[model samples]
Target: MNILVTGGAGYVGSKLVPKLLEKGFHVRVLDWFLFDDNIFKDLKTDKLELIKGDLRNSSIIKKCMQGIDIVIHLGCLSNDPSCDLDEELTKSINLDAGINIIKEAKKNKVTRFINASSASVYGIKDENNVTESSKLEPITLYAKYKADLEEFLHSQASEDFSPVSLRPATVCGYAPRLRLDLTVNILTYHAVTNNKIVVYGGEQKRPNIHIDDLVNIYLLLIDAPKEKIHNQVFNAGFQNYKVIEIANLIKSVLGPDKIKIQITEDNDHRSYHISSEKIKNTFNFSSQFDIKDAVLDLAKAFENDLVKNPNDSKYRNVKHILENEDFINNKILG
Candidate 1:
C-alpha cells in the first residue's frame, strides 16, 4: 500500500517513515524540509520517496494525494508559540492548508486519514480526566485549528474514507529530527547540559506520550479495522503530571546532584490531564513509555554526543521560524 505522510521530515515523521518502509509499504513524504533537508538522507530504500515542498502548494499536494491509500497528516506549524507568529499566516499555513489536504484526500478516495491532533485543544480543563468526549476550549490559535481540522476530517468521512483523529499529548523523547522545545525534552536537555532546569509556571499539569509509542499508534491505525477507528478521536497520552513534578522526576532519574530546579512565575496557564481510556478500551492501545523513559532516552542521546548544542535554533520550531525571516517569506510562505 502507498502511504502519503505529510510533514514526513518532522520529529515524528522522521521516525515513522522508516518504520513504514520496513513494513514493506511504499512511503511518500511531503514536507518543506525546514529543520533538516537531509533527515532521510541515510535511508537507501526503494519503497521511500521524498518530496520537499510547501503544503500550501495545491499542485504539490495534488501530486502527493495520488496513489495514496492512507493519509498520515502530521504537517503543520506545531505548538502554540509557532502559530502565534502571525495570526493570518499561521491560519493560512496550518488551518487553510489542512482543510485543502482533507478535501484532496476525499477527492482522491484515500482509505484512512490518521490525523495528529493536539491535546492542548482541551485547554485548561478543570475536569480530572479530559476524555475524547470533553468539549474543546482551545486557548490558542494553534489549538483552535487542530480542533477545526478534526471537525473537517470527520465531516469528510464516508464509506471508503475512515478518518481517525488522535489528540496526542505533548510528545516527548528523541527522534532523528529532535525537538528541544517540548516539556520533557526542554527540561531534560537543560538538566543534562546546564545542570539546571528553569521552569516557567511549573505547576500546570500536562499530558505527554513517548515518540516511540506515538509512532506505534500511527502504525497500528493503518492495520486497524475501519469500524474501530472510523470517524473516531482518541486521546493518545499516558503520563499526567505538573511541570515541576516532571522536572523533579528528571532530576531523580538523572541523579539529583547533577540537576537543580529553578522555578519562575509566568502567566502561561494552559494545562490539562488527558485520559487515554478511550484508546485503551476501544482499540486496546496503550502507551508503553512515559516521561521517565523519555528523559532517560534524551539523556542517553545527549551522552552519546548525538546532540552537540541542544539550544540550537534547528531544534526548535518557533525559534527556527523567527531566526529565518527571509526563508519564511521567500521559500516557506511562498
Candidate 2:
C-alpha cells in the first residue's frame, strides 16, 4: 500500500508515518516542513519519501495523487485564532485546497481519503455529551471550515472511493513534533517546568483523546468495511471532563507543591463535550490511553526536555506559530 500523508512531518504525522512504515506501507509525506526539515530528518526508513510542496499547487498534488492508494489529509489552517489571522488563506487551504485534493484523488482513483476533522464543529453547546447526529453550530472560522469541508467530502465519495472524517477530540500525547499548546500537554508542561497553571472558564466541558489513539483511528478507517466507513463522520474522543477537573487531575500527577490553579470566568464561544460511541461501536475501536496516563507521560517528556527545544515551528509559539503566514505558506507548498 502507498499512502500520501499531508502534513506528515507534523506532530501526529511524524508519529503516524513511522507506524505506517512499520506496518509495511510505502509512505510519502507531503509537508511544508515550515520550521525545518530537522524533525523528520532522523527517520531512517527506506520506504519513506518526502514531497515538500503546497496543497494549493494542483500540479504537485496531481503528481502526488498518481499511484497513491490512500490520502490522509491532515494539512490545514488549524485553530480559530490562526484562521482569524488570515481568513482568505485559511479558506484557500482549509476548504478550497481540500476540495481540489478530493477532486484530484477521485480522478486518480485513490482508494480511501480520510479527512482530519475537529470536534470544534459542534460549537458552544451546553449539551452533556454530543453525538455525530447533533446539528453543527460552528462558532469559529476554523470550525466552520471543517464542517463545510466535511459536507463537501461526503458528497464527493463514490463506491470505489471512500471518504471518512474523524472529528478527533483535543489530542494529548508525546510525539516527535511535540506540541505544548494543547490543553493537557500545556498544563502538564507548566506544572513540571513553571510549577503553575493559570486556567480560565473552568466550567467549560471538553472531550479529549490521546494522539496515539487518534492516529490509530485513521488506520482503522482504512480496513473498516466499506459500508461502515464511507461518507461516515464520527467523533473521536475517549473521555470528557470539566476544565477544573482536568486541572485538578494534572495537579494530582505533578503533586500539589508543583502547581497552582487560578480560574477566571471567561465565556468562550468554543465549548462542546463530544461522544465517541458511534465510532467505537462501528469499528470495534477503543482508547487504550486515558487522562491519568496522558498526564504522567507528558510530565515525563517535559522533565526529560524531549519537547523542550523542538526543531520545527509548529511547537514554537502555540499562539504565534499557529497564526504565522510563513507557517501557512509552508503547509500550502509542502
Candidate 3:
C-alpha cells in the first residue's frame, strides 16, 4: 500500500512517517521542511519518497497524491495564537486547503483519508470531561477552522470514500523535530534548567497524551476497518489534570531538588479536560505513557542536551512563531 503524509517533517509527522515505512507501506512525505530535511535524513529506504512542498499548492498536493492509497493529513498552522495571524490565511490553509485535500483524495480514488484535529475545539469550559459528542465551542480562529473542517469531512464520507478525524490531546515528549512550546515539555524544561516553573491558571483542567502513544493512535486508525473509523471523530488522550497538578507531577518524578513551582491567577482562554472513552471503546486503544514518564524523559534529554538547543526556532513557542512567520518560513539562523 502507498500512503501520502502531509506535514511529514513536523514533530508528529516525522515520527509517524518512519512508523508507516516499518509497516511496509510505500510512504511519500509532502513537507515544507521549514527547519531542515535532516529530520528524515536517517530514514533511507526504497519504499520512502520525500516531496518538499507546501500543502497550499494544489499542484504539489496533486503530485504527492499519485499512486497513493491513503492520505494522512497533518499539515496546518497549529494552535490558537498562530492561527490568529490572519483569519483569511488560517481558513485558507487550515480549513479550505484541508477540504480541498479531501476532495482531491476522493478524485484520486484514495482508499482512506485521516485528518488530525485538535482538542482545542472544546474551548474553555468548566467541564470535568468533554467527549466527541460534546457541543463544540470554538473561541479561537484555529479551533473554528478545525471544527469547520470536521463538518466538511463528515459530509464527504460515503460508501466509496472514507475519512476519519482524530482529535488528539496536547502532545508531550520529544521527536526528531522537537517542540518545547507544549505545556508538559515547557514546564519540565524550566523545572530542570532554571529550577523554577512559573505557571498561570493553576486550576484549569487539560487533557494530555504522550508523544509515543499519540503516534500509536494514528497507526491504529490507519489499519482499522472503514466501518469502524469512517465518518467518525474520536477524542485522543490518556489522562486529564489541572495545570498546577501537572507541575507537581513533574516535580515529583524529577525530584524536588530539580524544580520549584510558582502559580499565578491569570486564566488563559484555553481550559478544558477531555474524555477518551469513545476511542478506547472503538479502537481498543489506551495511552501507555503518562505525565511522570514524559517529565522525567524530557528532564533527562535536557541534562544530556539532547536536542541541540532548547530555544531553537523549531522548538520555540507559538507566540514566537506568530511574531516571526518569516523566521519559520525562511528557516533563519538564530
lDDT of each: 0.89, 0.82, 0.82
- Candidate 2 Cα misplacement greater than 4 A, ranges: 310-313, 316-334
Model 2 lDDT at residue 208 = 90
Worst 10 residues of 2 by lDDT: 310-319
Task: Give one digit per residue, the lDDT tens place, for model 1 in 258-298.
Answer: 68899999997767799999888987776788888999989
Give me the displacement of residue 136 in model 3, in angstroms: 1.2
How close to the true structure is residue 299 of candidate 3, measured as C-alpha lDDT? Answer: 73
User: If both were scored by TM-score, which would come out higher, candidate 1 or candidate 2?
Assistant: 1
Q: Give the Å error, residue 106, model 3.
A: 0.4
TM-score of each: 0.96, 0.93, 0.94
RMSD of each: 1.4, 2.2, 2.8
Pairs in clash, predicted candidate 2: 31-334, 53-333, 53-334, 54-332, 54-333, 54-334, 55-332
**lDDT score, candidate 1, position 236:** 88
lDDT of 3 by residue, 162-196 (tens): 88889988999877787877889888888887889
Please name the candidate that would achieve the greatest TM-score relative to the true structure. 1
Most accurate candidate by lDDT: 1
Off by over 4 Å in 3: 317-334
